[model samples]
Target: MITGPLCRAARALTELSREKLAALSGVDEHVIELFERRIAAPDANVVAMLKSTLEDMGAVFIPEDRRGAGVRLKFTASETKRIATLESEGGLIRGDDVP
Candidate 1:
């Protein structure tokens, strides 16, 4: 059985070279690279953006706290609203029609 690549949380989120992810996420390239290489870990908000961006790419995040215990998905109520607002602003989902 061949196991798929299991990247670190940061790597999984960026899914691109540090330089590219930096441009896409509007974060510093060095900082993103450091996080992926385990030299640093981003703060909660940065991580949350990375996670949400990855979701659009069909990638899922499993918190390290819940690793190795089967599928682990963390859902934050606030994050959902943030995503909704973001989508509304981007016009991907219409919020005006609902409320």
Candidate 2:
């Protein structure tokens, strides 16, 4: 669980929903929420997964060390919907929180 400003910005700029992001990233949505909330540190794999997913959708995610560059994410509403559907359809999400 690694949280950083760069990661937060990426989450905000991306169209992927938290649940879908986590599922597609092979992580729990709660962990994705943690990263968005900046409450937990996202490990290298988590960062890598997120970056890869974004890149596949035509977004360029810069690592924390490379945040100074003009990296950007380009996604339309339809693309977002598509990505969400892809992730959700795969049934990657697994959670049964009682709280």
Candidate 3:
């Protein structure tokens, strides 16, 4: 199950607005907003719908465990290449070389 913070983070990472996510998930806009704000709890079906929609858009939900939960983008081939190039150009640290 995706937590409120994780859901919000996924939306931010995917550049998806509340309205956009509502439309894509077929859930109400207000429902999405309230859920993301942690003001309301959505039922299981609604949560599943949101998670499915986000997964389709490349957002991978990390399950809660001892390490805690989160979300991250499932990088595509182009994204992988772009990140590698950026790292090579000093936009990011190479390998585990960050100080």
Candidate 4:
């Protein structure tokens, strides 16, 4: 179940404005605003649509557990592949100094 905060966090993680999200999800912009503000509650179907839209835009909703619910941006396929290749290079590891 997605909560108001979770939806807002996911939207932020995905860098989507309410207008954009509503356009993509076929949800009303006002409804999104109300939901995020915790001023109103949409039906389960609306929540599902929002979640699906966010997920499609790379927002991954973390299930609630000991750490609690959260949202994160998922890496795209190319990024994942590049990361795997870089890791498999197996070169010497060193820490860089930050100034």
Candidate 5:
């Protein structure tokens, strides 16, 4: 289960507004606001819906552990491909000269 803080953080990372999230998740904007503000708790199903929608938009939810739960953005397919291509480019490794 995700916490209210996680939800808010995920939304920020995904650059999604409450209205936009509500529309995408089919949840009420007021419910999302209240939930994020820690004012009210919505149904479990509603929370799941929000989580799924955010994930689809690139928000990756980190499970709770010793360091605590968090949220991050997943790299898009194009980004992954570009990174792989760059990694496959064999070149001499050199240290940067800084003084």
Candidate 6:
């Protein structure tokens, strides 16, 4: 299930405008706007279409876990290595300083 924020994040990750997403998913642009605004819940079919379109575009939806639900990009090995390099260089945080 795609939550509002997750849907928004997926769109952002894919560099998709609301109009583009609507065109791809066959959902109305206004409905997508309302969904992202958290003002309305779309029908299950709409949700499915959004998810399918995003997945086809390389967005993976993480199921709710202890940390929470989220969306992530499906990266290639070189991209994964680049992210690992950044993390190893202290470009990312692991929360070790949290009290």
**Model 5 over residues 1-99: C-alpha lDDT tens digits?**
777788999999999999999999999999999999999999999999999999999999988889988899999999999999999798877889887
- Candidate with top lDDT is 4
Model 3 spans with C-alpha error above 4 angstroms? 80-99
Where in model 4 is the C-alpha error above 4 Å?
Answer: 90-99
Per-model TM-score, in order, reads 0.46, 0.54, 0.76, 0.84, 0.86, 0.75
lDDT of 1 at 6: 25
> Per-residue alpha-carbon lDDT of model 2 for 1-99, expressed as tens digits?
224555556656666677767777787888767766778867888777876765665566544455353347777789899999987887666798878
Give the candidate number with the greatest TM-score: 5
Residues 13-93, candidate 4, lDDT per residue (tens digit)?
889999999999999999999999999999999999999999999999989999898889999999999999989898877
Model 1 regions lying over 4 Å from their true place: 1-15, 63-99
Off by over 4 Å in 5: 90-99
Count of clashing residue pairs in every prediction: 0, 6, 0, 0, 0, 0
After superposition of all CA atoms, the RMSD between model 3 and the true structure is 7.1
Candidate 2 Cα outliers beyond 4 Å, as residue runs: 1-4, 62-70, 74-99
lDDT of 3: 0.88
Tens-digit lDDT string for candidate 3 (1-99): 787788889999899998899989999999888888899999999999999999888899887789988899999989999988977885644588558
lDDT for model 1 comes to 0.52
| Candidate 6, 53-72: lDDT as tens digits | 99988899999989999999
In candidate 6, which residue pairs clash? none
Write down the worst ten-residue block by lDDT for model 2.
Answer: 62-71
User: Candidate 1, clashing residue pairs?
Assistant: none
Worst 10 residues of 5 by lDDT: 90-99
Worst 10 residues of 4 by lDDT: 90-99
